[model samples]
Target: MHIAYFPELALLFADIRFPQDQSPNNASIHLTWRPPHGEAKELDVPLLPDTTSLERIEVTMHSSPTSAYKMGETHNKWLSTCLGYDTVLAYLGENERPVLMSTHQKSNQPQIQQGGGWLSSITSKLPTSLGTIISGDTEPDDKITFADCAPFLVVNEASLHDVSRRLPESEEMDISKFRPNIIVSGAESCWEEDYWSELQTSSGVKLHLVQNCVRCVSLNIDYATGKPGEGESGKVLKKLQSDRRVDKGSKYSPVFGRYAFLGKGDEGKSLAVGDEVTITKRNAERTTFDWPGISSTPLPTAS
Candidate 1:
């Protein structure tokens, strides 16, 4: 609920901080913007979930003023891991307020209906909290496939905890090990593995729960704090693989994550905190998990 709209959304500045170099004046990550829809217009936003600069984007939708700033997956990850945040979904009523539902807080909160094009409206029912309007098509309800096309509903922090419980203390959370765009709050909750399967927010945003996000060694690096990981991110990831959700060994399952194609209408809606998001069930199964490999895919491939 609370569908607030803005025209010409834009990102003014971006920066990232890491524990490796926690200096207050350290030059955090930054990005260069060309204009409203410059040559970079065709370029995809960096989908990487961890990098600070990659986490933020400047969005301007349909001449709305007060340009909306979209936070990439990293911001979501921090919220769950560092903060205890959860949400539900619903559509905006005539008054532009979210309706309520009796659903438990799931891993992928405020699931946005995903698919096609960048300047579109995502009307999902979300637990009253935060929301953002994004560009892209919400994958059709019947067309399910695992590709980068699905919107990400990641659980970075829970994944870390899942890993920590299994692995020895020596292996802790390192950003390089599990780089996720969104991290949910709370412990003992298999946010990524179980909850994501069928969860949504109040804003009528649809989230296609694809699969458990797999991890790469990049999480081993301490990006925020800026120090060679003492091997924390890896430890949590390994533990999850061994004990938590996504048990590949039992059935030879390839590790995969979920994706939701954004929905239609309200192209380029502005999402902000304290909005309603909604998630609905789709009869479609996701496509195969085919995200470009970590090493092979770079920021240049976001579009």
Candidate 2:
């Protein structure tokens, strides 16, 4: 319903792996804050301090910011970012600065060509008759925190179970692809970006609603189980497009808005949970709302 907090530090990490053989004991993910509602920090470390105890650090997701627009699989998975548990433990102790890593794979992570890079190649696959493809604008400062991004928003236990049953036989739910930042309870029909657009933090940072996020087939891939197949999440979105809302051609309709950037965060620049928000209809003002499946022309705005 509201913006929670502005990220003091954002970290982008790649090539993450956790051994399935053991339960996380020394190092794990946890949210910690000072007493009486103090600073919030995610610790990937252990509580007890010992010579071999693990330390914690926050990670900034790379795919969402860099390659999400293009649907490149090379760096899409979380495993691409996180390292072995023991290695993460060692890194925390050694460095206090924000960290970013690319898995040692010889192959390059698939990159999205915004304006100049991969746009032409991606559009080449789509039928030329489909019209022009417009690249959505990117706002650098409008980054979200890990707390805001969670998969539960798109699917939960009950929804997952029902989805599995309703899905065609042999079909699996690749629920991880949506990669929701906030798993909200009782959200309205509007896209999350529309909601985010109307949001303002206590710090007076106006959340800028830049563009409606167009999703790709990646949602068809499951993050946790790493299963590949079309299932619940994609089915639901496809259904939403076909039966009730926009036609299939409206995939890039900007159902959700992207945060363009954040304002200043001073001592008073703090965003908390449960703040007031005003809703602004999405694409409502546009004379023509069309989804350019894929096109070579650069988007109207660059910033």
Candidate 3:
């Protein structure tokens, strides 16, 4: 998916027009569909899908020296027609937004991935789309695109295996199902992140284990089938609720991943795969949920 101006979205989400009955943007998305050989019809009254699904699909993006950052008026009209609903697209102009702080580090104008046709050669650079940072800080902080919440989600490979062993349908549990940004493989046991406080890489890049990540219906979507699976009582989610219900606030909303942020003074350092990470800090006192039985223990098998 491509990135859009964050401010424009913030405005749209807060727009009063969306609250009106005729405003046309409903809580549920309406899809116009046609069967293989039967009459065309619409789906349910309220689809209740997440907003990410609405971002227009791009078959392939070719770099153009002059591709407009703001989509033209015709393009906006075309999207409305294609989506079969009244939709509006807007662009956040350069210099329209200010630098902001996240739970950690800073979220400024968008920075982006830089690379060629392959993965191994890729790097990152600040995006020119959002103009220079307006903050007084001499050096710029990290650039972030729009996000639903915090920036990074860390996964322990051992944790996935642990969850599978507890579920009846293990085949459906793939690493991709959780969608983690970083996956560490050598943890001593599963669910250890519930107590991890901070970590550093061999190169001294440090990150703080901020808080628990709450699971939502979004996780139920099967990447393999593109269909959200739900038993009569939601078997997969039930299994999570039964054992992974560490968050007492809402035991129904089980958590499986840890949200992390860049530790202070570690902004310039980057985390690469296989960086020989070490647990720079650990906390034994449980906050939200204890990892089954792991408590106050130093991160084991940390590389």
Candidate 4:
């Protein structure tokens, strides 16, 4: 198999897709690339020059979203050397395999609260609330790309502002770094999401809050330079540990936003900007973590 190095495929491929309604002759792209082979280093060619004359890639993607990528032995070897990393590339001419849906479950443990923000109930117990966690895991029925867990990630606009105000603001600190699929803004929206396990949009779209998105080192990457080691991400995380560590069951892991999935029978509808969105609290509980504002008094921290 053979493939090209496209770092944008992870996030940008959705926009470059060939239209399904009509012939995409004008939408075609003239791609030029430098192959890792002989005298012909760079080549320019028209992608999908025409419907009949176009070179189509077919792949049965069971794991990845697209199968139009391939990797050859020589290309693979060259890529590893040039990039200083080991990688194998392959292109699927057509989708022969399909992605399937998998299930996940939140720990059915006693809930406890850590800090200010949402009403997160936490406890030092194993999960006792075992519910089906339908995630974006690889499977055999649905089509999914290289996404990590779920289809959509939900973020609270108010929460982003809250994190910014609490932490040292840096030029690198932009909401795009979090990359949320849906951004919700309202009074106490972030805290309400912790309880918005299931809710509906004005367009009759339904969403389910599944898991609290755990923070990672990747958050530290400086978006401007595309490099890590910015102390901003670290400082925000420390503040979360100090302020946002609200989940008692999972106190160690700092989370900002929530992960969500689409509701059954609500697929295919478009959720646009400025849509009136409302969330209902199906499961209401209070946080037990000792912090200011919750009790209107400061609690002692363990050394």
For 200-294, candidate 1 gives per-residue lDDT tens digits of 43444444454444443333434433233454452433434443334332222324234333444434444433333332342232223322332
What is the Å distance of residue 242 in model 2 from its true position?
Answer: 2.3
Per-residue CA lDDT of model 3 for 66-90, tens digit only, reads 1113344454564455444554443
Candidate 4 local distance difference test against the native? 0.46
Clashing pairs in 3: 284-296
- Residue ranges of candidate 2 with Cα displaced over 4 Å: 1-177, 182-188, 191-197, 230-237, 240-257, 264-268, 280-303
Per-residue lDDT of model 2, residues 130-189, tens digit only: 111111122222223232321012212223333345566776443333343322223333
lDDT of 3: 0.45
Minimum summed lDDT over a 10-residue window in model 2 is located at 118-127
lDDT of 4 by residue, 194-229 (tens): 654554566666666655655544455443333443
Badly placed stretches (over 4 Å) of model 3 are 1-145, 167-172, 230-234, 289-303
Alpha-carbon lDDT, every model: 0.33, 0.28, 0.45, 0.46
Best by TM-score: 4
* Per-prediction TM-score: 0.39, 0.35, 0.52, 0.55
| Weakest 10 consecutive residues of candidate 4 by summed lDDT | 122-131
Better of 3 and 4 by TM-score: 4
| Sequence-dependent TM-score of model 3 | 0.52
